[model samples]
Target: MLKYQQIALEIEKHIEENELQQGDKLPVLETLMAQFNVSKSTITKSLDLLEKKGVVFQVRGSGIFVRRHKRRGYVSLLSNQGFKKDLKDFHVTSKVIEMDVRKPTQEAADNLNIGLHDDVYFIKRVRYVNGQTLCLEESFYNKSIITYLNNEIVSESIFHYIKEALGLKVGFSDMYLHVDKLNQEEAAYLGLKEGAPKLTVETIFHLTNGQPFDFSKVTYNYEQSQFFIQANNELL
Candidate 1:
């Protein structure tokens, strides 16, 4: 583990052991100085690292205190190593409402590898987290494999649907992240004010059978959400 990570774990242990609580001051510099057996610079770096990760907050002179707890479990499909996550953990409700065929726009055509006016299927959804607006995801699938979308059995995560229900192999996807000013319509869907800043992630998902199958664009508030990645030395 990285030194900072080890420090983080130590602090977490302290917190778990009730040495710290919400709004409680951490040990003073002189106290930590003796406990960690490290230089002041190293200790400071570790505290700063914790502060940046939202695990701790520093008061002007009172010292650091526990702030937010780590999110705990996060899994991303592209990395392909974590346990199969149950979407229920997100505390979000997702409904895939409409799926229809439409002609691709010039930009959509380029993203999905379809002709400018070629037929494509549009999958629209509204996702909520903890009963609050979270994201609006619009997925476009290549017409060939999109026959599955014609069914009404759309579930929580589209990736899971394609892989399990249809017995399709999924792997390798490209993602693009960007920030944009939200419009009134999108903000309404997300329960945010108009012109709010939002982070958008667009992904082109490909299947292991040598085909690019899905393109999706999702918009959500960055201030309200985050992402996590886990690594293992063991080969996946």
Candidate 2:
């Protein structure tokens, strides 16, 4: 699975480098096989994945060509259970970009309420909805809280692991939404042009014991997604 993902990424890189363009035909399977040094099955699987993502389209008796995708729909962050539970129409998937314990940036340290010297598990993932890239999320977890995190755990739901494996009860989370511009890393992962406008959500999660254990920032492709918020009347 990981190998196929790497091949898909390399194909995306080719598109980014202008080696491919919208409506431009793709190279033959043999060409791709030699280019990536992979088997025929691997190349076919890679193209199939890209096709599902609306990155390329196939023609009967003809070659594959790039397709300009018009990504649509909305994903909710209104619940603490995560987007998968909240989304009704989309099948969500995650690609783990990196996972390692590292010194926290000042912003991450402050949000997770940890000291500068404290090391945290930094996890980065690119999330997709029915094959269309939606967002890139970077999460910082207190090592003392989720001490067993790895790439495999990240490919699944971290919230699930926190509650089920670690036996931690989530109390509440504070979320701040903002309109931001994409940075280079985010732009590349989401396949967006540099400095594209995005909707960003920053969240801090706390345990029942009042310990803040997780801090995450998720950036969404604004054109492909929307956010809905509900407000109820309360006595002041």
Q: Per-residue lDDT tens digits of candidate 2, residues 109-183?
A: 998889988989999999988888888999999997888897788998899999999999998888998997888
lDDT over C-alpha atoms for residue 88 of model 2: 49
For all predictions, the C-alpha RMSD in Å is 10.8, 15.9
* Candidate number achieving the greatest lDDT relative to the actual structure: 2
Strongest candidate by TM-score: 2
- Write down the worst ten-residue block by lDDT for model 1: 79-88
Clashing pairs in 2: none
Error of 1 at 227 (Å): 1.2
lDDT of each: 0.70, 0.82
TM-score of 2: 0.66
Candidate 1 lDDT, 1-236, residue by residue in tens: 57766877798678767746567778887778678887787778888767655557777877878864345434343443212342335576666766788887676778877786767788777776667666788888887775656444544555666767887778678889899899988887787888999888888878876567778888875455556643232333
